[model samples]
Target: MNAIQLKQMTSAKGFIAALDQSGGSTPKALKQYGVNEDAWTTEEEMFQLVHQMRTRVIKAPAFKGDRIIASILFENTMNRKIDDKYTADYLWEEKQVVPILKIDKGLADLENGVQVMKPMPELDDLLKQAQKRHIFGTKMRSVIKEANEEGIKKIVDQQFEIAKRIIAYDLVPIIEPEVDIHAPEKTKCEELLKKYIKEDLKALGKDQKVMFKLTIPNIDNFYADLMGDTHVVRVVALSGGYSQDEACEKLTHNHGMIASFSRALLQDLSSSQSDADFNKMLKDSIEKIYQASIK
Candidate 1:
């Protein structure tokens, strides 16, 4: 890679955005913000509302700073136009936020305490779509509901398999094997997760690499070794269900893992608020999350 390309990768270190969510996440968010339930019934209406909401958040004046290095988008929103430009282009051209897509279909039935990705028959097409839209990377979700060896192994294998394909498409992959916060053995699961991630990364040729967006382990600083791995370009954390304060506190203890939060980053802003109010709230959240990232 050229020096410029290498520098950009290294600079992609903190506050990656995660706007690509599906299923219950949308409805849950609407309820939390006191939006009317009737407005969310149809897919058409839901997508329109979600597009508007995500657009405001992504292009808000508050995001014009350098702290938020990247953003993930849902497929539907990726194609929408804002100010006569595609959403992805607008983010890059205007705000300098890297665009990424969430490609996995939502989760399916729980099996062996692991939530599997629903059958995604169109991931290849999705990658092509993301590329056409100028997306810089892709992310997918797999959850470890329990910390058993069998469950963790299944989660890791499935994620890496898809992650491999993402790499082949010449786009970066944020491999997320999330351990549920409610799991009884969060530490054990994290240890197992580290082991499997290291092994998978080792088998790759020297040139191959991927980023990780992992759950913050129950024990603080547990992921220091993995964060320091040469093969791991960047390590980011998910908020799961934690409140903003809680998420930021735990994030401070985990060295080198910065925030890529979904809910925690959005909890303070509401659709009912004025645009100015929303922006102010968003600015405050970004400052707090960014501070937590560097703390």
Candidate 2:
């Protein structure tokens, strides 16, 4: 583990950038950036286009550790390069932003009103590769659609189980069990999610530490206790389909959690914009999110 990155993760006054969109989400991410489906046919070409988009974002003047303390990268992105350096290396070396890799294959089928992560049979190899590339941590996501205690428990347990393995490799894990913001029982879902997380925290070894990426709660400061727990590094909130404005507003009401936004962060950017226009837009977005995070 990088001691400097660990200290930054725990005490940085900035938000995380969720640039980890994978196979399924890549096309949507491209479309929002003004690249149409016809832009690329082959999966390799598709990834190349998305990689170009990511490169633009990373090289932008506003994308430094001053406001973006870290960034989450998809597996493909981790293996790629930015400015002749590996993506993770460029982030830490040039920008001072910690690089975290997304490790989940994707979500499983909706069962028991939740979607646990698909099996990651190659996690060990990937973790080894991540270590070689200087990745500081990992992020994996599961989803909760309702307040099914059994399902939520499974999600939390699976996350912590994998977290322990990642920790054994000396990498922090950001456990993400996202509660659907539109669920009818959203509050109840968060309540149950918290209960399960608290239980899992107790089971962690004394020296182990982890982070969380969760949906903005229905109640302000709902995860306050978790934020203050000794085992937690930092608690971050995902945009969870919220617009930038809405996500920023909600973030202010929560004292400790910071933002780890993807859609909201990129919504204003497009391939059509000039470099000047693009940089200005990204700078404005970063300023808003940075202020919201430090509140």
Candidate 3:
């Protein structure tokens, strides 16, 4: 198979499986799988447990991306071997999804809300490593809860700030500005997001491009502005706090956006299951998400 660039990853077909949990939700997921978090006093202690979960989670029954997931965004720490091969290599070898890397250092608080990718001094080195390993793209996140113009501005500004750097390194940036689904201004905030993102991307060089990882808006097709933008290769939706059923319903309503979900994608999966059970759960989730993505 040939290498996949950022544009091709989006423009070609299918949704993105946002499995780059970054260990942020690992404890909760592990607990759901019947793992005891009380014994592991430190995150590092749970490394093997997380990797075990990842291995099981990634054994997605092989399928074409035609009506399924186009790619996967793997956690930065998941570069190690699975079944005597790198997990990314296994995914690529099986022709399941384009493998990607998550390079952000995680979120930090702004005066108003949340901003992602704090103190990412080593991101350049990481991208070079991903390139060497043939990872397709990267995903970073910033979140907004309500309509604070200054906070929204900060979110977009910071996103483009890192996006330009990622492009320079020849990686597609999945720019995520996640608005809380329950926010009072869900509709209003989405309108503001379109405005800010459009303004921000217009300032970039003509050759520049980005994929958006957005929150599902209250109304369907609420992101026509972004989906229509030439600079936007694709728009992918995040589950935020929605259940799988609700998320799938909302995702189908949006014309251009596809699912790039984390929790929603893994909710039904558990580490305690046998290999057959785990794979069955994956197939079920993939089927549901695939149906939604093509809708």
Residue 10's lDDT in candidate 2: 99
- Candidate 3 lDDT, tens digit per residue, 104-217? 777787556545547789878888887777676677887787788888888899899998988887777889888988888878778877888888988989878788889998
lDDT of each: 0.81, 0.96, 0.75
**Comparing candidate 2 with candidate 3, which one achieves the higher lDDT?**
2
Local error of candidate 2 at 189, Å?
0.6
lDDT by residue (186-253, candidate 2, tens digit) is 99999999998999999999999999999999999999999889999999999999999999999999
Winner by lDDT: 2
For model 1 the TM-score comes to: 0.94
What are the models' TM-scores?
0.94, 0.99, 0.90
Shift in Å, residue 24, candidate 3: 3.5
- Among residues 3 or more apart in sequence or in different chains, the pairs in candidate 2 whose N, CA or C atoms overlap within 3 Å are none
Model 2: residues >4 Å from true position, as ranges?
none
lDDT (tens digit, per residue) of candidate 1 on 182-230? 8888888788888888888877667666788888888888778877666
